[model samples]
Target: MSKLLARIAGYLSNRTLVGVDKLGNRYFTRTEEIDGIMKEKRCVIFKGEGDPTSISVEWICWLNGQRKRAPTAEEQMELEARREPVKQNVAFLKQEEEERRAKEGSSHKAKSTGKTGGPDLKSFIHQFPTEGNKLEEESDAVDRGRGEDEAGAQKAKEPLSE
Candidate 1:
């Protein structure tokens, strides 16, 4: 097919190696003349099974032309190192919060009416009749009124015997 031939031709064309990700995927770019204008083409060569998810955000941005330059190894390393401390801090805070909640949950079991330690508005609201109940009551009253009107109309239609 012409598309397959074009792909083969593109692979054969001279492409500059931009970067290699931690997953061993290689990224490359090439310039080609199309419609009398020079355009840049980018592609990735997977190291193994070609899983798209294996690509990092930075490399994805470069591949999609969202970034002007490919990510450097130093930048990636620095970001990874920075993320480690943040992850540790998050875990520590979560554990601390869980411990506090456990203590409060045991000691204030009766005092706590809800999650916010305030009156449960949901239960309070349930004590009142709902809109559907109100509507049914109103309709019953109207039906009773209609019955009275019918009875009065029959009386008015009766004649007096003198």
Candidate 2:
């Protein structure tokens, strides 16, 4: 019904029916001058739902000028084949993340940060070891060189309280 009306409208408006999808959506185009430059005016009159999302990715590309024309059968098949790996990769990542969460510490399973609004110090320090934090390593070495007894003796050597 609408297709017939579209054909009539196309003829009257000088727009040509460029392509039709399997779902019955019709793509129409016509040449019109915009800013004195002749350009092809394109639009899609949806068949049933008229929803933009109903347009296939390939059709969307053509409509948006990413493609010269509607995708061929081979191109659609190739796209479908390519999607298989991406879908599998996404599923694998989700499963791996779930396993990580299951094995992770309960504290990490909740919020990663402390109550002070700072990063999780334990996790951060563990991930990036003392190798990168030379200051902390040096402080530890100095503390070890000066034993607790020696530290106490050094403090005692200071002037007595008045």
Candidate 3:
């Protein structure tokens, strides 16, 4: 009767079971035996959380102590890196893209229209270097005064009421 009890205990201890979720997470449990004799205790071989798709069934078996392969520290780190959470700000990214597009469109329209002196504004200043020329300074001052005058004129043209 003792021999039969010992054999039953041993068989139970040596048995292994594994459970997996849809997300590839896995859990493994096994019965433990000591000195060829089955014990009434159970042990966890592997209890990991992550996408199971990244880990193979064979790897899981090894992790559970059912197979011979042992996981190394490097492997563990690599798996951890893969499982790390990714941060994304989709709304902010989209807003930035839209602003960039609007800037491009306005710049394109400015180039196409003869407004703002077109492209000659760049080369003209380069060709006529400012070298203490009073006339050039006066022209710039006049341009500024003229801009203010135009704004004032537009305001004065508005209908007046008593």
Candidate 4:
């Protein structure tokens, strides 16, 4: 009876089932001439009782003529494979950020006890040059600043002018 009804409704004129989705929605196609150009009319019969909005976007694309045919199982698998790596990378970055925050917090706690074991060093420790136990400033033989005693001696050595 359903076959007779479908035939009467013109939906069965040249319709052929092409694919079915995971949710069991059935896709169909019909070839016809429209304005002298051969075209395929694609559509779907959704499974079970529900709103038509539940139809998957891939199926929608086929039905709307955006895609040549229903998406294949292999295509779905490829999409999943491509997405897995990105998901893993995002999770890895999140874990690394959490570890950095935890290390920073622990360093703050260690400072209160004055234990000189961890990464606690003055910020400017590396700002100046050093060789062995001496810094570049201490090793300089020339006192470029000119001490008070040197200024007084130089002034006394100068001849008095009229």
The best candidate by lDDT is 1
lDDT of each: 0.89, 0.82, 0.60, 0.78
Query: Which stretches in model 1 have alpha-carbon errors above 4 Å?
Result: 1-16, 30-41, 49-54, 94-148, 154-162
Q: 32-147, model 2: which lDDT tens digit per residue? A: 99899999878899998888888889989898888887676677678878988999999999999988787785546555554666565796667555667777888899888788
Report the number of the highest-TM-score candidate. 2
Candidate 2's TM-score: 0.50
TM-score of each: 0.49, 0.50, 0.19, 0.39
| Model 3 accuracy (lDDT, Cα) | 0.60
What is the C-alpha local distance difference test score of candidate 4?
Answer: 0.78
The C-alpha stretches of model 3 lying farther than 4 A from their native spots are 1-59, 63-67, 85-162
lDDT of 4 by residue, 1-162 (tens): 998897787663788888887688888898899999998888788789755787767778888888875799787567767878999999999999889878988888533566557785566777665667556566453464567669989989999897
- Candidate 4 Cα errors over 4 Å, as ranges: 1-13, 35-38, 80-162
**For residues 36-60, could you state the per-residue lDDT of candidate 3 as single tens digits?**
9864432233345434446654455
The segments of candidate 2 whose C-alpha lies over 4 angstroms from its true place after superposition are: 1-6, 20-25, 47-57, 105-108, 113-162
